[model samples]
Target chain A: MALGLAALLFIVLCALPVFYMLGVSLVGADGAFSLNHYFRLFAEVRQLDLFLNSLLLATATSLLATAIGAPLGVLLARADLPAKRALRILLIIPLAVPPYVMGLAWIYMGSDSGIIAQATGRDFLSPLTYSLTGAVIVLSVSFYPLAMLAAEAAARGVDARMEEAALLVAAPRRVLWRITLPIAAPSIAAAALLIFVLALSEFGVPGLLRVPVFTTEVFTAFSALYDFGAATALAVPLLALALMAGITARFMIGERLLVGRRGARNRSPLSLNSRRAGLAVTIALALFVLLPIAALALETGRAERMILALRSSVEAITNSLTLAFVGATMAALIGLLLGYARARMHRFAGTVDLAMIVAFAAPGTVIGVGLIGLWNRPGLMEEIYRSRLIILIAYLARLIPVAALILAAGARQVPASFEEAGEVAGAKWTRVFARITVPQMRAGIIAAWVVSFILAFGELGATVLVAPPGQATLPAHIYTLIANAPSGEVAALALTQSAVVMTLLALFAVFVFREKRLHS
Target chain B: MNDSFLRLVNIVKRFGRREVVRNLSLEAAEGEVVALLGPSGCGKTTVLRVIAGLEAPDEGEVWIAGRKVASDGINIEGPRARHVGFVFQDLALWPHMTVAGNLDFALASVSVARRERAARITEALRMARIESFASSYPDQLSGGEQQRAALARAIVSRPGLLLLDEPMSSLDTELKGELIGEIAALQRSLQVTTVYITHDRAEAAALAHRVAILREGRIERIDEIASL
Candidate 1:
């Protein structure tokens, strides 16, 4: 019964945001339900342009992220890369850096007095950080890890014996094209779709780069215009696109990759012999990964100037941490219960999992819009929205799906028989869960906790739209700091944010590694 | 003997449209080792689980040590109340548990004193020839050792009827032969009624006093090793 309640809690947490958006999208300034807002969205060419810009940006980011990520995935999974373990770790750290921080780092490099501008003598804003192309570059860098992780996992799933068979009959290129790529297609498509959804919902890069995508327009409507109805209406297209992409990604990646065998840990790393290949990968890493980080670090040295520039970064850090803790705690509790239910009660698992993912795929702006639409009415919920409770609810809405997915992955490894064995031995279901199930899934629980925490900490899209007056999160604060401060201070503050995020992520990675060692 | 220990009457289980265990009925005497032998997917494991109450039959009844655990008209008890011990094919030994923890979990409801529980764990480890490895995790142990740990865990509760579901499938050829004799010896010494399921005919013939071969969810024959 407790498990059931937990599932209901998570499901409601996910649904309320989307429904709230839907309610607000339909309601008008006159406080009556109407279709005029949506009609206005289609009829206005500028609004339509914003929609197109977001769509095109999402498509480009997906392609670019996939193109960059797929080869590296193949290298990591199939080829022998130098310092492979260190490289894998480095690749994942980018994910830990919040998208807004990445934007600030780019701004520091590309701005008029930016380090890159000083060093290269090229106008920083000439072609990047202030245009549509700049948005794509930033979004791709932020989201490529999605493609990298998924493609690598899929590459690992291909039987080495099949590759051997292909090698026996043909050249390496033919074998790769004919057998390996085809086999890894589902995962590749899944990765692309994931990147697409991420790009569609992205607010920070486009906002920082001064591009007016749909998310930005929504933010503008809420913050500047205070037109909650228009903001809610603007998010409808993004939500629909994300939902469609998420569904297709699910179908393409189906149940085949769901159950990973224990033997997957034994994958043999492929060797790369060409020096040119090594040079290419190193150069790519240098340009895309190292450059941004170097710029952020250089900017950090001018700490006094940065401190003078942005006052809100420090307070935003505290608020971000609080919301992150709340979101992580709620997600972990809800995730554990839902994972338990799905593992034990087989009947409703698919439906529950789908509901959670649907909630995740819905854009944060939509959620913010939804919350305002639903609770701005005079009622008990209205009071809750006026407080800190609604912000936490937004975090749950965005994070539960990720927590559930990671936990579910961990829960799958635990054989149902363990629980059955415990029950038959005379323990109650709750006792069995506590004594047997929880211990076995400790690593997964930790991973879920960290994932939700990091995602929550960096969360900006929904917070930007819905954060009550005087309430600013870390990312939102850092963002405002960049615009409000001079180049040196912006750079310094961005560096501090990066350091804190990297430290937390490193600690999480270490914990996960220890858990793996404990289990293995 | 002892009110038929554990019994099943006309158990029917279906997956969507296909019946996996069709009108299957079986019983365990007080201390008999009745091996449910069958080809892959013939529903032998399903029968073992039905008795242990891990599964509920669509259209019949299961009585565990004289208590009605499940029936067509009513479901009386869950797996916990059945007082049954099952050794899964996967050896689903809790990977997080040490050998001692595995045994302690099984013996939780036995009403044994704390000291008695500790003593029973030591005895179970000794009986399974895994005493030296009691502190180790399941993954750290060899396949044969894990099999032994699973058996020790199942038997620690002193269940009236024990179910072994392809318990030796994970072991190597050499360990399989060695452990078969050890398991048979433990069964004889403890005199626990056993329903051992296996697709391996040799294992069924070697470990079972009476082997019942099931084909396509129905029992084809029950015979002694010499007769086979």
Candidate 2:
């Protein structure tokens, strides 16, 4: 009964926004069923431009990310490089630093009065810095880690003996091409498609770089033009694109989307030259991880400015921290029940997985518009919408699906027999869950919370749209300050956000290492 | 011993701090079937890997077909150049390829002429009695058919040495008996130098001309099957 309630809540919180948007998009001004919004979307050249630009960004980002990330993944999985654990963590730091923040760093480095301009006494890079290419670069740098991690896991999952079987007749390179890569191709392709969808759905990087994609266009139509109908129309293309990509990725990845299991103990057939691979890793870290951060610090200039920026944005920062904490807790708790149900489900689990993937893939601006359309009027919901609670609801709408995915992967690791044994001992379902199941999945629960907190903290697209007056989160404040406030203050705030996320990640890593030691 | 086609001398292999194969030595004459029989983790499979150049021993030498393939913690020759055929315990058939495709890949790797490749694959499939399943992927085939496909893939390149590591462990007893008989006949006809690893004494006794019993990481004794 609890599990059923959790599923119902999941649908209500996560799925309803997308459904409401779909329903609204189909209704005309006359309140009759119509396809006029889509018709207008198709007829307008500006809309076509938006579509093409979004497609170009997503495609280029996916291809570049995969090109850079897949080989790095193979190297990490198969090469005899030094300090592998540290290298992986360092590579992943760019992902934890949100794309918008990275965009800010690039702007500081390349804008007319920015670092490069000061260093070179010229404005050579500003054109590329503020263009669509800039958006793609920033988004790719932020998302390639997704592809890298996915490819690493996929490569590691290939049976070592299969490669060995090929090795007996073929060279290591041929074996890698014929045996290892072919087996891992599906997963790597799925990850690329997922990155494509995420790039399409991204609002902040494109918005910051002045790229007029669907997500940014949706935000403009709603906030600047006050044309709700136009915004809803703009969001339809993004929704359809996300749905298609989500279903395809889910099909390609199947149950292994989140559940990572290492294969046998034998060494892989493929091994890269350690020195060359190490050089590549170093260059990547410098370009993607260190450069942007150093730019931020350089622009921020001094410690006092960072403190002053923090003090000025104290309310927003506190709101972000408190809301992320509460939101992550709620998301983790709800995700635990839903994930347990999804994991134990023998039927319709695929359907549930598809729904979660679509919800997670839905662009933030689309969900924000959907939430406004759903709750901006009508008694109780209107009251909630007028208060700070609407921002929390937005967080739930955006984060619950990802939390459930992480927790479901965790839940799948615990065997069913453990619960069955609890039942045989006459323990109630709640007791069994609390004592036996939850204890076993403690690591998953913490991981889910940490992931949720990070996502919610960096969340800007939905929160900016849904926040009540004077209740802005840190991301919203930083975004609004980008154009109005001093560049130094904005850089300091962005740097602060990155620091918080990195500290949390470091702490999580420490916890994991300690757990591994204790268990070993 | 000097004329042995496959030889291991003073092999010592360690994974981390634990020694897995400790100063083990073994030999198989040309066309002879030697079974390294032992309990699980008795280093029999490691010995097969060492001989095939899949692994280099920490303190030993391996000679296959009169070539020093590995010595002093280094692989002098890689697995491909060693011309070895290995059938792993799990079979490890490539799932993405059809049975014929698998055999074709093996033959092509050895630089078999493209014009003769189809006939070689067909001959291998025919020898393994899996000719009708050439178009089928490994997952589409039955357990026994998959085993035959794995065996066909192993011998497709006409390798100089053959290594089998509990290839029939997953099959039922009746099928195991039938496959064992077929394998013995195939070995006799091909005259390939073979090293078979098994924990089952019955399998060792049934097909091996000689059995080397191992305990921990060392050989306890070598017995001629005629004496057994």
Candidate 3:
């Protein structure tokens, strides 16, 4: 009964906005069924350009990310390397730092009088800096870790004995090519598709780079033009793309999407030349992780400017931290119930997974538009729309699906027999869950919270659209300051945001390490 | 013993601080089926692995077919160069490939010509009584069929030595008896030096010319199957 309520709440909170948008898009001004909005969306040259741009960006980013990430993943999973754990954590730092911050770094590095110009005494990279290619590069750098981690997990999950079986008659290289990579291919492809969807859905990087994608167009349609109908129309293609990609990814991954199991006892036979691989990894780290951060710090100039930037944006920062904290807690609590239900349900679990993936994959601008259409009404709905509460709602809508995914993966790790044992000992269902299940899921719960908080803290697309006047979050504030305020201040704020996210991730990593040590 | 086709001398394998196989030594003559019989964690599988060159012992040497394949703490020749076949406990059939494809992969690895590969694959499938499932993937086949497929893949390359790591552990008693008889017949025909690891005493007795009982990584005794 409790699980049913949680599912209902999830549907209402997460699914309703998208559904409402779909419904609203199908209706004309006369309140009758119509296809005029879609017709207009299809007929316009500008809309066509937007569609192509979105498609190109998503495709390019996914391809580049996979090309860079899959080899690293193979190395991480199979190679004999030094300080692998540390390297892994460092590589993942780009994912935690928001893409827009990376965009800001690129802007600072490639601007007319920026770092590159000052160093080289010429403005060579500025043309490529604030363009679609720039957006693709920035987003790929920010999101490649997703592909890397996915590929690594999938590779590790392959039975080592299977490779050994091949090794009996084949060289190690042949075994890897014929057996290991083929087995891990489905998962790698799925991660690439997911990266495509994420890149397609992303708003801030494109907006910063002045790339006219669907997300940025939707923002302009609603926020600049006040054309709600146009905004909803613009979201249709993006939503369709996301839905298709999510369903395809889910099919490719199946149950392994959430749960990663370690393989057999034998070590993989495939090995890399550690010195050369280490050199490549170090170079990648320099390019993808350290360069952007150094640019941000360099552009921020001095410590005093950072302090002043912090003082000026203190309200926005505080608002962001508080809202993200509450949002993450609620998301984790709700995710716990829903995730447990999804994990345990033998039937309808695929449907639940589909819904969660689609929800999570829906672009934030689309969700923002949907929320506005749903909540910007009279009475109680208007109360939410006109206050800071709407931002939290937006956060929940955008974040719950991911939190549920993390928690569901956690729930799967706790064996069913443990709960059955608790029940056999005369414990009630709730008691068994609280004592036997939740305790075992402690690490998962913490992971869900930390991930949710990071995502919510960096959330910009939905929050920017839905936040009331004077209730700007740090991302929205930094975004606005990009046009008017000094570059130093904007760089400082972006640096501060990255620092907070990195610190939280570090703490979570430390906690997880300690937990593993304790258990082992 | 001097003409043994497969030999392990004072093998010691450790995982972390636990010595899984310690000071264990054994030998099997050419065409001999020697069963390494032990309870779980008695290092039976480790011994098979050492002979196969899949593992290097920390303090021993392994010789296969008159060649030194591994020395203390090093694999002088890897598993492929040793020409040993292994059927893991889980079967470990490549799920992405058909049974024919699996066999073809093994054959092709040894530089078998494409023109001759099909005939070899067909003969192996026929020997294992799994010709009907040649185009089927491992998951598409039944448990018994999968077992046959694994066995066919192992022997398709005509390996000098064969290692079976409790491959029949998951089967019921009836199926186990059937497969054991088939395996014994296959071994007699192929005349490959074989090391079968199993905790089941009856299985060891039914298939082996000699049974070496292992207790805590040490040989307790080697009894002739006829005596048992």
Candidate 4:
């Protein structure tokens, strides 16, 4: 079946590289199977420190993000706040902008000559600008919407009658605490764990913040020291941590996590009327949504410099745009089949969910190292590994699972009876899928494509690791120049990244609105 | 002055100008049972909701236990403030709470002391004949058992007015008949003012002191139902 090939493609592209790295981690210099690599990994105090730093960073990001996002999510789902739809869209704009660009904005705000210093005529935030706490703040602000969305879904999942039953006797606040929040605990915890994994796997934020985490160390080991063994070894711990967290999150959410919250729209029982909730949403919008973006624009003032910055990094920009397009297109196409297969699958689907999340959560540095271990050999494999094709491979490995998950969520919306109706009419399975099922899920498909494109465009971690020597993507170039280049030029590049991403996001939003109108 | 404990006067409810309930008026005396019978979409549930203070009337006045609770374009009191017990058509039992916890929540809502909550909940469970299933969640209990739990939750706070909206709509004929008998006995013993909303004429005849047949959101007829 076509679905089998899509599944097989993921197994070969994503799964094999990880397995290859696992094999490499197990083998010693003598070419004998051994635990020496792991032994050495734990034995070195520097490695242990790196591991601890990564853990703390992940923990802090998860906790802080949840703290900020969970309340907002609850408000969005239950509050009778004004301009709710606008507020939700504004809050989610951060997800469109890459985390590193956010880090860059924060840096500009907190640097010695940056916004905070110039405005205040003193430097308080500059000391903590490139610190672990700074990384946590940037990553948390960038990823908080994940928690927010998850929280809203979980809150909506609570049946209206359940709350009304409580409201018959208990106060609304008591009903929320005792009935709504407790029921939503699994989703909130799952979102927290997901944030933890994402923060741990993140390379851009911590790297920019000068936080010496596993990802950065792995980069240093391979790129600077040329010690492939050491780099691969460093990745094992991060890989293990991301996989564990991803699997745990998947289990916590179960199959319902993939079912979108369309069912929640009709049942609106919990209505909160409070001025304080409105104030909280406004403050959150100003702080998390508007502030960083305003800082970025303020730092990059002139149009001419932005033009010059784009021209200078022209090769990198071209490569990034082209590769991202190709990568997103491939990911969407392949993800459709995989998503459909997964949606229709009844038995052992949990295992598939676990596998996808683990793959999707694998640290970019680890996947890059795994790809090199698997393909950097003499003959045909070496030939392909040295080309730009390898970079595309990295993108496929990193992003396909995410795309598939999105599509699967969409696919689940189509009732099984629709497909069954087609089959009963003597249509083939492919025809049934295309004419009946796919048409019903058109919105989900477009959403999946847009999300996939955005993620692919902003991808840096794995691309940075796997890019051929002397080659640079826009992100890799901007990051490399930040140390030595003028603030104006760096700001321009960062702003350009935001502009392109936002413009595409606007287009996608328009497309979705148009589709909704047509459907209506 | 109305002689009834629960009264709705010239109540009007509209959802986007469809006018669900138009100039509807009803009353139930203290410690009396009155059944409002109608076809589906006859605004029977809306009347119950208006009385329970869950839904505000567009043009009407609702008074519970001699206190004005809601009027045209204003909800003067919330469901909790009016001390009303409402069991929805679906028997909206909180799935998260155990049967005892459900009763406890009801008692707590009426601001009962934590110490007395346990005893009150037990007595409520005993009255509903579901004492052995105190630890059971709504989903864990059988349909009949769950029905008892919902009844227990409603009466736990000892509300001045009790509203039932097709509570046995999902039950089989055997269980429905049994619950109807039990509910009648409980209403007689407790002597709380009650309004029963149902489409089934048999249900109306089985429990009510009087039956009001509703058509197009208006009272078509009022007949005294002889005791079954």
Evaluated with DockQ, which candidate comes out highest? 2
- For model 1 the interface RMSD, in Å, equals 21.6
Among all windows of 10 consecutive residues in model 3 chain A, the one with the lowest summed lDDT is A260-269
How far residue A76's Cα lies from its native spot in candidate 2, in Å, is: 1.8
Q: Give the per-residue lDDT of model 3 (tens digit) for A319-350.
A: 99999999999999999999998888899888
Give the poorly placed runs of model 4, Cα more than 4 Å off.
A265-269
Measured over the true interface residues after superposition, the C-alpha RMSD of each candidate is: 21.6, 0.8, 0.8, 1.6
- Candidate 4 lDDT over residue span A418-465, tens digit each: 889889999999999888988887877777777777787788888887
Which candidate, 1 or 4, would have the higher lDDT against the true structure?
4
Which residue pairs show collisions in model 3? Answer: none
Deviation in angstroms for B6 in model 1?
60
Cα deviation in Å at residue B195, candidate 3?
1.6
Question: How much is the lDDT of residue A462 in candidate 3?
Answer: 93
Q: Candidate 1, chain A: TM-score? A: 0.92
**Candidate 1 C-alpha lDDT tens digits along B1-228:** 346877788989887799999887777678888898878999987787677665678889888767788997355775556666678777756544588876775565445678889999999999999999999988899889989998887888777778898989877889999999999999999999899998888898888878887999987877776786
- For all candidates in order, the CA lDDT equals 0.76, 0.89, 0.90, 0.85
DockQ of 4: 0.67
- CAPRI band of model 2? high
Best by lDDT: 3
- TM-scores for all predictions: 0.67, 0.96, 0.97, 0.96
